[model samples]
Target: MENYFLGLEAVHPSCLAKIITGDKLPKKAIIWEFTNEIKPIDLYCYLQVKYGSPNGLQNFLRNDSSDNLIHWEWSLAGQFGIVSIQGHNFRTEVHLIGEHDGKGLTLEDFIQQIKADFKNHGKSMKSVRVELEKWTRFLNPYHRINSVVAKNIKSLNSLDVKVDEDRELVKFHEENLPKLEENWKYVRDKYDNAIGITFGLRSMLPVLAESFINLIIFVLAKPEIKKNERLLQNTIRQQIDIRVQSLHLNCIGFTRPIDYTDDVCKKFHTLMNERNDLLHGNVEVNKLKIGEVYFKGKVPVFVGYEDMWQSAMGISLSSVKYNTIFDDHAVVTNFIEFILDHLSKDLKEQVQYIMTNSELGYNPANGRLGSLFSDNIADFRVSVNEA
Candidate 1:
């Protein structure tokens, strides 16, 4: 039950003051700062392990390379609120407020969680501790501005003018820091709704795909069901008791089933296997190889890990081989497109409505989903066309 105070400013102090004063909509807030000892990619992995793919309850996302920041918040059923990791040059700072619920974990607990997650991922924890210690030093009350001024030294350059201004600055920071915390609730809610769309699609794609298959079965079996109503009804009830994959295969077989060799279906099957692996806790990182020079030390687990955190992806001793899955977000997009291309006109409209309603579509879904097929799936279609 330790108290954690908000610290530092990424934007100008005056701009932050304006935000606290409600003169401007605060574009962002600061939570923690660290030198190059801690990398953004490590933070990204920490998030993936902690929250498991941005389900709004514990959602997070990294910005583009230009921004080089990760935006996320403590979302344990309304515990901690919005937070951001801002990186500039070789330094990074996590900025956030403790406004939402008093039950959020203390700063020490959160730091320990990171250390544990890092060590569990087969990485060293000593470096993590060193960087965290720096954060503690920065936040130390003994070294605070208020304390420095209290023990006035004659060597201070602008003694009279600066001291008076410093006192007022301290007063301003104290008065408005709590006010900024309250204002951030609105900002956090907006990001949560947007992240929810991506999360929902990932979880719901398989169900939607199965629904399309079921529709196909319903249409094809209509004549049989009509002819032998009682018998067909019993058979249908029995079929419903089977596994989803079997049902999907049976429905596909009834309709001109796409073969295992077909590229789209092949990819879809691979995605389904990977999704099942994830759901069942069988996910693993594929061993890393750099050209002819084999590296047994490293493994690629998450989509961006190979690109961002190569060092942290290493295994000190053992070698374990595993199959790779496309990024979960990529899998969702490809799966939806696969279904969209096969469904009937009336069915397509229903699928569109399901995905694009105010609940899912309120934030990012409309623009993102609309562009997904056009921008991403279009390329796949081009290769098929060429073939």
Candidate 2:
């Protein structure tokens, strides 16, 4: 908690004259919800005019290039000590801070007083009728997909190793053949699950990449690019490869575009092709070559064919291995990094913040103000005295 009182010492003389010091800190608070129709700045301006210059006012802003307001605090005249007023996320709260001795203003009393003031000042402070709704766009889906892919790979590896161990046991003792067969069943089931999960990853990775790049352009693109709806739509609708390659040059005026031949760029295009194959239901199948031969007492029991035949279809997803998924995931991450690296320092930092935080703060007028992380909230003042 920060001692906002320390700053109050320098308040204007007229406001300071009304300030009162108390032995006990204020504990009671009254909150009023406002419709989004009213902006926080408008209410703050009104308070400034009504109470003259406040003892202290602080604007808590987003930690991004936008510098949009997250919340604000104003210390005004108080009968007890200093009354604190805060506007945050479409709500205003007034805190009572002084020695009341049971004779100070009550909650209802202050509510009526504020209501009258609003009415006299020609302000229509409407109370919220419905619960506040919050919508968040999570930016870390790539990371989540990577996690699922990793877990699937780990499960597959464990099943494969078990199957190999069972085969070795069967070789030593013919009676262990049943165990080997059972382990093979486990491997088959796991393989089927992996195929399905990997297919989803393949489909989503490309889409996530496209969404990410377009999001960057939408949020941080040059003013002219943003203002023209048609241009913005056309740019976003372009082939993902074109968007990825041109992101730097199109969004930032001077940076060089990523070369199509760059390894990262090439990898991204390959991922897109794989996604396209899946989307278009393109199938390719070739005769699988048999590899290892398993024998049961001079009788061939099992013959290992290439892994491709086991795929859901002859689709490219059939060739996906754990390493392949890892590489594809890396391509998206690396390409995003490459694009961000070419951005100006400030833009890079802002985009990085958006990517790192899970929840985006919404402003009706601005769409997205920025993100707010739990740690950022933890560091902020929880109460007026801590402001």
Best model per TM-score: 2
Model 2 stretches with alpha carbons more than 4 Å out: 1-45, 56-71, 75-82, 87-93, 99-108, 123-197, 219-223, 280-323, 340-354, 357-375, 379-387
Q: Candidate 2, residue 379: CA error in Å?
A: 8.4
For model 1, the local distance difference test gives: 0.37
RMSD over all Cα atoms, model 1: 31.3
Give the alpha-carbon lDDT of every model.
Answer: 0.37, 0.57
Question: What is the C-alpha lDDT profile of model 1 across 252-283, one tens digit per residue?
Answer: 22323334455655565655564465356663
Q: What lDDT tens digits, residue by residue, belong to model 2 across residues 1-387?
A: 122222232345444344433335554443334444344555555565465443444442335332333455666544445666666553566555554435544545544454445555543223221222344545454335445555654654554533245334434256756686674565556656666666667777777777677767777666677778888888888888777766775686326667779888888888888788768877643322223568888998655444422332223333654347757777888887877777778877877776655456654544555554442332223443432
Q: Each model's TM-score?
A: 0.25, 0.58
- Candidate 1's C-alpha runs over 4 A off are 1-195, 225-256, 277-387
